[model samples]
Target: MPQETFTLQIRQIRLETDDVLSFELASPTQNPLPVAPAGAHLELHLPGALQRSYSLLDEGLGGCYRIAVKREPQSRGGSAWLHSQARVGQTLQAQAPRNDFALNEHAPESILIAGGIGITPLLAMARRLNRLGHRWSLHYAAPSPDRMAYRDCLQALAADGHGSLHTYCSSEDRRLDIAAVVRASGPQAHLYCCGPAGLIDDFITATQDRPPERVHYERFAARHAASTEGGYEALLARSGKTVKVSAGRTLLDAILDAGVDIPYACSQGVCGTCRTRVISGTPDHRDECLTEAERQSNEAIIPCCSGALSSTLVLDL
Candidate 1:
């Protein structure tokens, strides 16, 4: 089915912390919104073509969508705009919820690890697991207690014995040992992590020996590494055009320069929106969204941040 768009009115805006704020959006006509499962996110279509993806924090809340946004000092304007211009009475356009970091609900035991603003999605997972009486634990790490967004709710979950909550505060000299936490979760438990690249990389490295399917993660941003050497040629099959993708220029930009239209959001390679079918060619596969199996298949490529390995490539588009 094609994705749907809706206009929602901001009913409430509550500050979760010094830098984070939670916005509750509801249908303007008081109609029920689409039901979004835990770990789902919505793409907000802000003014000036500034689109940003935010995770929904509503685990059990009904008929509305809740999202927490953290203001980033070095933001590309999305967070800053929301923090400064968004108001309770304002209406915003947003895409329906989509889940790229879905939880494995059938797992007997689950382990959740979060860092900073990454806790938004995990918080919903924790709530669902607790309500369903599933065995789970959460480990949240932040710079300090004042920076943690949902401290009170997490504490209440721990107090109720629904799940164990372990917090690490860098100001208090506490460290989150990724290896220790992964090892303690046991081999059969499913692990979900969302955080900074360094933390996610550490967890991935620590769990390399474990079953790959048992470990899941979501990254907030793309890892900007040194580009590969040389330029490549991309053949747009549908457009009957050939475009030169320079080493400094991304494939998506090259294609667009050739007068081809492709849909994309979060050009950082974290979102799978720019995923395009590869009729033929070897993709360099720099994107963080695709799984190992998907990368190995070479059936699709995320053009926004990924490049081609072969000199000449063919794209379905």
Candidate 2:
């Protein structure tokens, strides 16, 4: 099946932070925008073939989707254009919502780690957990107090007794101790991390010994044109085909570039459209679409964002 294309109109824009703007997008033709769960993202097709994926901060029954965009210091035209040129009532093109990060409703508790603008998806998870009367905690880090987005909402969640919110500001000489946080979590608590590559790497290191089923993460595509998660060899079984995916390259991109056809929609591991079988090797499971059981089995891999935890992944291609 093909993904749906939508004509979205920017209905409103709210200033989230000094550098962040939250846009309220709705379909201009009264067509309902795709409903997305917490931790979902939508790809906005902008001018000059500039397509960028944004975390869906709010998905309402009123056919409106809210997403936050932070003006990157480098400004590669996606966030910069949204900040400068995107206007209310102007129509834009986008894909249906997809999620690479999703909350685990079944876990006894959730431990969320976020850095900078990475709060977008985690905020949604906090709200969902609150709505469901679940216990959760958020460890958020930012440059300064003012730089944190949705601080009021997170504080409100704390006030409402939905979750605990902890802030660590680097400017104040405070930092989130990944090891300490992981060490403090209960056994059944699922851990989720989405932030800068460095933060993610630290989180992974701290939780490496934990059950693979209990850890969930999403890649932050704002930086790192290739995967910063390291790289390895992908050996296709049938033709004995092999591609050495570099530290900066993704398995999906490398496979496609090799003219090896693999159907994939959202290259961020949300859609589950590109799930491939793994005959051998441990996969660095980073997709929300797969369950804990699936990950524990280590029988499949979402090649888009996921990589080989082992040096070589034997694909049953």
Candidate 3:
């Protein structure tokens, strides 16, 4: 399936809180909005910045497209740029929606756990679940009511509907009761969570007894421990250039730093953006998007998150 990337001007920007904004992009563009399910996210190519991924909050039917973004205290510059600087009427390049967190049709009950900004994707799931009248529950954890995105709307939906929505103000409470929520779910219920790495780790631990396939997780950051040795050099066969990327930096970063552009999204590796043909070299795969066969072939790897394991890896570029 080919994705249609389009440039749209920002139609509106609503401040959800001090740092979060619910951005609305113009809908009537050259490429029409496709029908996207809950958990679908778009890859944004910020002006003069690396590609960043954001979950789609609004359904495709709306005349406008909405996405909620929270400014991170220690961001790599993407969120900070969007939160503090990106203005309405500015044009931004965005790719078509990609969904890796769709609801499990086999699941009788859906349990969503969100932490802080992680609520963006899960909120979409709640919307579809509510409309479908499915058995579902959401546990949203934030520092306070003010920090919660879409507070009034989420609360109203939860109150007026059958789905149970629970909020945990972590500033008031020491920690969210993950154990309780996991234990409360029925044996066959599906668990979907997206948040900080700590919450994800804890959730995985709590569900150790459950089947692994039933538990779906989305990580926002790189969890791999840093490499002990120095970084390796990359050889772009198609471009005929040799670039050096440090251990802390990624192959995609090095290529971009060299003024070369390649397709990429969700630098986290889940979006399969920045995927390119690996002509040669052993790649240190860190992405969660590729399948076992894809990895075994060593033909395609997500350069955004993956690095070269060999001294000199060649990419089609």
User: What's the lDDT for candidate 1?
Assistant: 0.86
Better of 1 and 3 by lDDT: 1
> Which residue runs does candidate 2 get wrong by more than 4 Å?
222-317
lDDT by residue (tens digit), candidate 1, 15-131? 999999999988898876777888988888888877788888865277788899999999888899999999998998887777888988889889999999999999999888887
Which candidate number has the best lDDT?
1
In the order shown, the candidates' Cα RMSDs to the true structure are: 2.2, 5.5, 3.4
lDDT of 1 at 197: 90
Error of 3 at 98 (Å): 1.3
Score each candidate by Cα lDDT.
Answer: 0.86, 0.83, 0.80
Candidate 2 steric clashes: 1
Looking at model 1, which ten-residue stretch has the lowest summed lDDT? 222-231
lDDT of 3 by residue, 208-250 (tens): 8998778887878757642324378888887788898875777
User: How much is the lDDT of residue 175 in candidate 3?
Assistant: 61
